[model samples]
Target: MFDYYNLEPVLMWIHSTMCGLMPEWLAFTIEGIAVGIFIMVMYAVLAIILIYMERKVCAAFQCRIGPDRVGGRGGLLQVPADVIKILTKEIISLKNSDKFLYALAPFLVIMASILTFSCLPWNKGGEILHMNIGIFFVLAASSIGVLGILLAGWSSNSKYTLIGAVRSGAMIISYELSIGLSVLTMVILCGTMDIQEIVAYQENGWNIFKGHLPALMAFVIYLIAGNAEANRAPFDLAEAEQELTAGYHTEYSGMHFGFFYLAEYLNLFITAGIAVTLFLGGWMPLHIAGLEGFNTIMDYIPGVIWFVGKTFFVVFLLMWIRWTFPRLRIDQVLILEWKYLMPLSLLVLVIMTVMKVFGLVF
Candidate 1:
C-alpha cells in the first residue's frame, strides 16, 4: 500500500519517458518547473487552510462562531473570498518610495519561504534537493526572509514601518542564536546533518525520547525561537497592530500585503515542519522495543501520513500558543531571547555534546 503512494518512482518513470521524447536537459527542466509549480500551489493552498484553521481555532477559544457565512456550515470559502478581494484591490504606492525595492520585498519573502521546502523531506526519497547539508540549508534559507521584511519597512519611508523593521531585525538577531544552538543540539545527538539520515536514526525511537532531557530542552527552545522567527505572538513585536498599525507592512496594500500574509503562514508551517523533522522523527513510525506485533501494525501505515500528522500536531501547538498569549513588548521579547532562551539553549547543546562523548545517548 505504501509502495502505491511512493511518488519518487512514479516521477522518475515520468522523467525517463520525457527524456526519451526530448533532450535530457529539456526534460529535466520541464520536470523541475512542474514540481516547482506544484509546490507553490501547495504552499498557497496550505496557507488558505492554515488561515481558516487559525480563525476557527481562535474563535473556539474566544467563544465565537468564527466564519459562518461563506462555504455553508463553517465558512470554508472565507479564505478564498479574502484572496480574491485582496487580488482585486488596487495597490497603493506612495510618492518618493523606492519603487523597485518596495515591489521586490514581498517576492523575496515568499521566495525565501519556498526555498526551504527544497531541503525538507516530505517522505522517504521525496526531498526536492537531497543536499548533504540539509539542515544547514534550511536554516540559511529561512533567515533570508527577514531581509524582505526589512526592505519592506525601509523602502516604505514611514516612521512606523522603520520602527517595525528595526524591532524585527533586533528580535531576529537575538532569537536566531537560540534557534541555531537548539538545532545544533539535535545535530550533535544524531551525528548527521542530513535530514533523511536523522529521521532514519530514529527508527528505534524519536530523539525526543532517546536523547532524553537535552533533546526535550532543545525542542522547547526551538519552539520559542521558531515562534519568534515567524513573528507570531507573543513574539510578534514586529507587527504589533495597536503599536505600529500593521508594522513593517503598514504601507503595503492589495497583493503586496497578501504576499506578506501568505509568507507568514508558510513560515509557520516551515517551523513546524522543521520541528517534526528534527525532533519528532519525520516520517518514521512508532516502534516499541519487544513489541513486534504493534510495530508491524504501525508499519502498515504510510510514511507520508505519519509525517503530515506529526507536522500538523506541532502546527496546532504553535497555534494554541499564539491564541493563548498576548503580544510581548519589544524589550521583553529581546530579553526572553538573550537573557533566557539563548543561555539555556547553549547549555543544552553543551550537555548533549558531553552526553554524546560519553555514549550516554540511546
Candidate 2:
C-alpha cells in the first residue's frame, strides 16, 4: 500500500524559502510565475501523451499499426517529432485577416484551460485555489475558451473558418446548458460548491451510488455534454474535416495550430477530470457499506493515484466513444442538446433536488 503524500506543502515550502531570499512581493510574484510555468509544462507533457495515446487508440480501432517508425517502441517519440515539425513550420499571415486577434486567439484558449486547473482538487488538500465557489468557477472559466475558438474562426478571414466557428459557438452554447444542469444536480445533492468538500462528502461512498438513479443520469448527461463541449467527434461539427476543411483553425499552421490542438486535448482532460471529481468521488477510495477491511486497504493507497486513475478511466471512455461513434451533423448536434439532453437534464435536476429534500439518497 502506498502511503498518502501531497505536493502542496512541498510547493509552499519552496515558496517560503524563496520569500526569505527576496522581498515579499517579489517572492509572491516569483511564486506565481513558477506555478504558471509548471502548469504550462504539465499541460504540454499531458498533451503529448494524450496525442500519442489517441493515435494509438484510433489506429487500434482501425486495425492498423500506428507510428511504429518514429520511436524505439510504438513510436513514442512521434508526438515530440510532430511538435518540432510544427515549431519549425512557417506561419502564414493572411493580408485580409485581423492580425492581433488571430495571434491572440490560441493564447486565450490555452489560458482558459490553465485557469481551470487552479481550482481542481488533485488530492486531499492538494488544490491550488480552494475557493468556496469552485464548481461555478470551473464552469465559468472553462466556457471562456469558446471565445477563443470563435475569435480564431472569425479572424482567419476564411469562409470555412467562419462557418466552423459559428457552428462551434452554437453547439457549445446549447450543450453547456445540459452540462450546467448536470453539475448543478450534483451540487444540489452535495449541498456545496467547494470541490474538496464535495469529494470529502463521498468518503464513505461515491455520489453515483449515493444518489442512485439521478446521479447516474447526471453522469451520463455530463459525459455527453462534456464530449460536445470538448468538441470531440460526433459533436465536432465545428471542425468537421470533410465539410469545413479543418474548420476554425483552417488558416492556422505551425505553432499557432499546435496551440489549438494542445488546447483541445487539455480541454478533453479537464472535462474528464471534472466528471471524475464530481460523480466518481474525486480522490476518495472505494468503500462499500459492509466491507470495512477492503475499504481500509483502499485507504492505504495514495489519494492522488485514485484521482488520476478515475480521471484517466473517464478519459478512456471518451476516447472509446470518439472512435466508435460517427460525427453528428450540426443540426443533429443542436437537436440532441436542445430537444433531448436539455430537457432530460432539467428533469434529473428536479428529481435530485426532491430526493435531497426528502433525505432519500443512499
Candidate 3:
C-alpha cells in the first residue's frame, strides 16, 4: 500500500536540513518564490519541446522534413526561434476589442493549465497537493480553461471570435459530460477518486484491461471526449483556420497570440495526463496475469517514467488524430458528442457499476 501522508515527513526533513544550512529568510525564499518559478520554467520548457515535436511530427506524417534549419538536422531550436519572433513582433490589439479581457484571457487559460498539475501524482510518493479528491479537483479546475476561451472571443468583438468562442464553449460543455461519465466509471471500478488509490488498483493491471468490456468502452469514449475537450483535430471546429481565419484569436497578435498557442498545447498535455491517470494507470506499469519477473522489472522502473511515457504516447496519439482527419463541422461535432460518446459513456458507467456491485471486476 502507498503512504497517503508521506510528504509531511519529507517536508520536515527538508525544513530541518535547510535550517541547519541556511538562514530562515533564504529557506523561505527558496521554498516560496523559487519553487513557483521553477515549476513555471519547467512548464515553459516542456511546452517548447512539445511545440517543436508537434510540428515535426505533423510534417513527418505528411511526408516532409519539419525543421531542418533551426538547430541542425531536426530543427530542435525552432520553438525558441518562434518565441523570439513573437517577442520581437508588434502587439496589435484591435480597436474594437476589450483590451483588459483580451489581454487577460490567455494568461488566465495558461494559469489554469499550470494549476491542474498541482494534483497530479507524478510518482507513488509525491504530488504537490495529494488530496483524496485529486481526480475531482483536477477535472473541476481544468474546466476553467474554457472560461478563458469564452472571454477571449466575446471580448474581442469580432464575429469570428464570437463563433469560435461559442463553438468551443458548446463543444467543451458537451464533451465534458462524456469525460465525466467515463471517469465515473473508473471511479466506480476502483472505488476511489484519489488518483494514487486509482493507480494502486492498477498495480495488477490497468483499469482499461481490468474491467474488460465496460472499461474498454469507457476508454474509447474518453478518447473521443478528451480530444473534443482539448479542442484538437476533428473537434477543432473552434479554430478551424481555413474556415474561421484563426478562430478566437483572429484579432490577436504577437505575444498575445503566442499565449493562446501555448495554452492550447499545454491543455493538450494536461488532457493526456488526465487520461493516463484515469484509464491507462498513471505512473503504474503493466503487469501480466502470471509474469512475476516481468512485473518485477516494471516495478524497478520509476513511477514518473511510466506516467510520462504513457502521457507522451497519448499526446502523440492526439497529434496523429489531428493530422489524419478533416475537421468536423460544429453541428456534427456536437451531434457526435450527444448522440454517440455521451450515450456510450453512460452505458459503460452503468455496466461498470453493475460489475463492481457483483464483484466481477478483475
| lDDT of each candidate versus the true structure | 0.90, 0.90, 0.84
List residue ranges in candidate 2 displaced over 4 A. Answer: 1-3, 6-21
Model 2 residue 306 distance off true place after TM-score fit, in angstroms = 1.4
Looking at model 1, report the run of 10 residues with the lowest lDDT sum.
Answer: 1-10
67-145: candidate 1 lDDT, tens digit per residue: 9899899898999999999999999988999999999999999999999966777887788878778999899998889
Model 1 spans with C-alpha error above 4 angstroms: 1-6
TM-score per candidate: 0.97, 0.95, 0.93
Rank list by TM-score = 1, 2, 3
Relative to the unseen true structure, what is the C-alpha lDDT of residue 7 in candidate 1, on a scale of 0 to 100?
Answer: 69
Q: After superposition, how far is residue 292 of candidate 1 from its true place, in Å?
A: 2.4
On lDDT, who's better, 2 or 3? 2
- The lDDT of model 1 is 0.90
Summarize candidate 3's per-residue lDDT along 264-337 as a digit string, tens digits.
Answer: 88778888888888889888877787887887777777778888899989999889988999999988987888
- Model 2: per-residue lDDT, tens digit, 226-315? 999999997888999999999999999999999899989989989998999899999888887788798788888888889889988998
Looking at model 1, residue 313 earns an lDDT score of: 91
